[model samples]
Target: MKRLVGLFAALLLLVGGLASPAQAAGTLNWTAGDSITAYTSAPTTATPGATTIVFENSAATGNTTGMPHTLTFDTSTEGYNHDVSLNILANPFDANNGRHEATVTLTPGRYRYFCSIPGHSTMVGEFVVTDGPGPDPDTTPPTVTAAAAGTQDANGNYVGTATVTVTATDNTGGSGVDKVEYALDSGAFQAYTAPVAVSTAGAHTVRYRATDKSGNASTEGSLAFTVVEPAPEEDTTPPTVNHALAGTQDDDGNYVGSATATLTATDDDSGVDRIEYSLDGGAYTAYTAPVVVSTAGMHMLHYRATDKAGNTSAEKMAHFTVVPAEEPDTTPPTVVAEVDGEQNENDAYVGRATVTVTANDTESEVASIQYALDSGAWLAYTQPVVITGLGAHTVRARATDTAGNTSPEKTVTFTVVGTGSDACEVPDTRTTVVIDGDDTGVPNADTGDGCTINDLIDEYASYPNHAAFVRHVETVTAALVAGGTLTKRQQGTIVRAAARSDIGS
Candidate 1:
């Protein structure tokens, strides 16, 4: 029995070694269901020092202008093992389906998010955290336009086949649409409700709804599609399209797509007014502005303009007639080619910018200017570069315009100068002191190099450092000994005079 127990312990240790720091599942499932932000984000960015724990209110319940939801993380525990909660429910406190989404950044380690909201955990959902970027922002929300709610049949009776034409677009790559589903007159909803084959003999009403794995839901307006059996002609007369022209995107469809405007319109009453516009045509809107759509193909301008009085025009009538602004390279001129200052490389005298200025705009004029000093502050200006105090200085330049348009940063290096190293000059020889040769007369400044020995003593006394004075006195004594300049007896006299100090008063 003891042998068997030891063998079991060894096996357990081996199993533990095989595990990784990240969750074993390899993916962190997010919260998704009836009470989730179908078109929002998780793991939203927060300033580094602001808050360590990431948070997002993706629940539909507390999301209605002040619903309560809490999110937090462990910044103190370094190696990443944190708790998460996603047990949100529909109104009236009931557990939702298996769908889930709970996002939070992890420290390259295991993470778990569970609904601590009562019994909802067993039914609602949970999530995990791993080291990877989150979902794609471009994944569109499922279009939820309400199809014509009612349509007539051959019997001239109000009816529904309970089947609506749902166009599902998938972004999981390759797959067009996986599944489609609809509810029957508010009946028990089922999983098989899309692209349905309703076999009702007459008309029926239905509600169509769907979503993608990213949990993007179709809107309410896309809910009901008219169920019909093909009626007679009625959409004749060239189908009068009210306003159709194209330019830029409007507030209505904010989706980021190819920046082109293509349009087609029809007027059952009167023909279209001349489509007049200009691209930089004086700050126009997506609908009300004028643009020169020079490219013959379709494009978006201020799609709609006006005539004499004021008739609403339509642009981008044909959804597919997109313009090619991306081709024109409308990305504002490169700010790089404009600024200057690449000289002296020093902390004191850094930038050598003589005339650092903003470049002339290709599309517009060089508007205004500004500058920054180190990582310190941003300053506005009409000047090219800013210089506070010259020597030992570091500077930067900023160029802008009246439109608050700014140019890229440009560097102009310069440096400050200071006094150089030049020591005090001195003469090699002077008629200041002298010494006679042999055992001769008394010592005197009159013996050789100029000044009297009395004056020399007076000057030496004025020296600030007594030690420096003593050292210079020794040098003078040695010079006398090296002769040529003084006689032997004079040298002796000089040495005696140099060594003697003024004693007492």
Candidate 2:
């Protein structure tokens, strides 16, 4: 009996040594029907490192012929055969039926427990391994940071579509990050699977948060950034260009002299950057001010304006001309003189005569007309000139233009004769004489109007009565010296004529 008691105690010690300790274990219960679900009061947490899991399968019905039930624990959340099984039962009455136990070495992490039967992974529960008492439960939420990748404009707004990348990290607890969610502005939250695209313009806010496996959610983190829609393709339309002039132009678009050309540019979108212009097909230059064109003949001007977006306007053209200054008039004027009266056969005038002078010019108007009689000073001719001399006389005329041009001098010669001299007979028995191709009578005393010393001298060379002619001339000269009607030159001529007639004393 002592030995038997000793043997029994040894058996009890062996059984106790093989049995699982209840201290480092977790009890989980689930009823398996068509699926598997956790019991109402199943323990969800266990001590870390070498924890024994106690599972109860209270499967009462719904087990088919080929379908079986088993308890499995693994890191896998799906796929029945992929998990490590703790215990499997072919039927509810089989070994370990309705109950299963497993000892697994686990770290501080969450694991999934499911039925290992085909199509039974959907029925599952979670088992968490934790460090022994002391540390609090995983309450530290994950931190999330969101960054955008894109260019920024001068206004500090993001240009175009920006790629928002969200990164979450859990550093405090063994529970890892479950998911990261992001919301744009006040919109609904969406799970972040990849980069988010933000394309709206103006100010925008991106809110993001991370939830850890322990159901702890981080405080909402937000990034405020401005989004701009690329500035509408950079205002591709160029500025319109218009050309203006500061002076009048002729019918042929010719300017009389110098003129300034101004360019005006306009843009409805982006403002004009600068204006460029070319003169007379020359190279292009910036248009800071108006351009002055002074050359003569045809000229061409090309201009264009560029906007801030680097778009250039279509080339514009303007045509014009500049005329040269008028030259000074240097041409001389022409003078014309005329006499108003009939002349005798000897080209002599017997009565009063009138002489008129006129001047003309092509470039400038005639300023004045000057006339001079024989051996006389020049006088301005305002009207016709009258001549009453009986002998040959000459009148000189000249003209001047407004440009200081003097015309060549012109002269007219004419002689005057009495009507009584037409007959070759004396008025009252006077002596007759022939001179050159004319016949005239000489006065006996030179006191009458029938003849004069001039007539005697003129006919002395052609007279057949040379002695008579000389006597008559000498008589007339003595009478003229007494009467003072003849000058010294006339007296000398008469003396020479008397000598030629061989009657000089």
Candidate 3:
């Protein structure tokens, strides 16, 4: 009993830590249940002994029997206590079968050896430990390996004649590199000669298979390398744009509307930096990040791009314009008579004429206009109004803001019926009214057409006018007399206005 307890204590210490790599570790071939005469040839009976032992997958899984018997060893028993067992399941995270020489400690006397398996306890055996680190477990298994790391170059691509360090190591014995050969992706094997060149573009993996001096060959492991072309000439070409992509049609009565357009472009060298744009010969503005537009108007859009080389791309234009559904005019324009006709005798003769006016506004301004004649036809008027044959017409006018806000009607009642030629003398109380395309002279010569003083200064540029303007038109008549350059009506009207002004002044 004393010797037995001492043997158990010795086994406890040895099995506590682990074994070194030199130990021969492997499993013995066994059938079902059996016992051997001895585990080692000469066994020792001392309290403390040293030697190594091994467990092997023995039971033969016949052509038709149940799966081979699973072997398991439990350190639950007092004499067989151990820190942990070599297992693929309940051990360290990285666990694989074939790792040999998992060292274990033991003492003299009958030590129990059991299969580290499930449902196979009857195959357990008792072994005797002798001197030295007990029976050495077979640590020699096919040590599979391949090449070491290759050169990782600047710019992250592999360069030069790539040489892979072809080396293989084993557990107990060093590499048996004689029969070792290399094969590339399922092709025939090549002897482990010199390092092969990996010059192909892109990435590639080379695998090495080491065959020991023994016929035993190790499985293949691979090393990866990358081969890429020098970045394709640095890509410095600038991008271009298309014009047929010009745009949709709209009635601007002027040009095109506002459009945030993208200039289609490409680069073969340094790539495109940005696309700038301008409209209606406007200042060039920064490009839209995603090439979008918000401004509304009819304009000429100019576009361009620049590359990293400081090279500017050819300017392109997308006559793109953003049009409002309808052009807006919001301002309430001041209404004035463009031309007033003659006033006849005392029937309150006030002539109706064209009130030439323009609207001023921003986005979607004045939508419509309303005019009431003598509190009548709140009618829509366009460019001209010929309010005919009225003794006195009360013209009430109002403008509607684009948003439908209507303004107060501006009413003006003027006498249209004039006194007879013998009874009425034309009033000369004229206030100087500055008008566009009118006479510049302050005390301008009056033309007696039975027309008033104001009418003389503001003569029609097209038809009847003062002497200075008449002289201009005569030059045109000279051109016409040579041919049909000027019409007869134009020449005659000029001659009449000049003669009439000379007599009236």
Better of 2 and 3 by TM-score: 2
TM-score of predicted structure 3:
0.25
lDDT of 1 by residue, 1-505 (tens): 3343233223211111122324233333233233322313343212211112223333442344322232223223444344322222222122221122333233333333333333333322222232354323435655443343235566444354443555566644211243456666657556644355554554445666656645566553234323444443342232222433344653554322344333334444334444433343335444333223444344334444344323545442333243334333222323432234443344443212233445555655556555554443555434343231223333466555434466667765444322122211222233345222222243443313333333333333444444334333433333333424345565455556444533211
Task: Residues 387-452, candidate 3: write the lDDT tens digits.
Answer: 432234556676665666566666655544323332214534343322342332333222222433
Question: How many Å off is the CA of 7 in candidate 1?
Answer: 99
For candidate 2, give the lDDT of residue 289.
91
lDDT of 2 by residue, 1-505 (tens): 3343233222211111122454444434444544444332345566655455554443544433323455545444453222233443434444444445555455565666655555565656675656775346788899889998889878777888777899999989856799999999999999999998888877888999999988999999998888887656458788999999766666766787777899999998889899999988789999999999888778889999999988899999888778875678888898999987767787676544678898889999999899876655687777776554445667899999999999989998766545665432443333433233333333233423465444434443344455545443544454355456665565555456455544322
Report residue 191 deviation for candidate 2 (angstroms).
Answer: 3.4
- Greater TM-score among 1 and 3 belongs to 3
Which residues of candidate 2, in runs, are more than 4 Å off? 1-43, 48-52, 59-70, 75-98, 102-131, 231-505
Task: List residue ranges in candidate 3 displaced over 4 A.
Answer: 1-236, 240-258, 262-269, 283-285, 288-298, 311-314, 326-505
What is the full ranking by lDDT, best candidate first?
2, 3, 1
lDDT of each: 0.38, 0.65, 0.45
Candidate with top lDDT is 2
TM-score to native of every candidate shown? 0.19, 0.34, 0.25
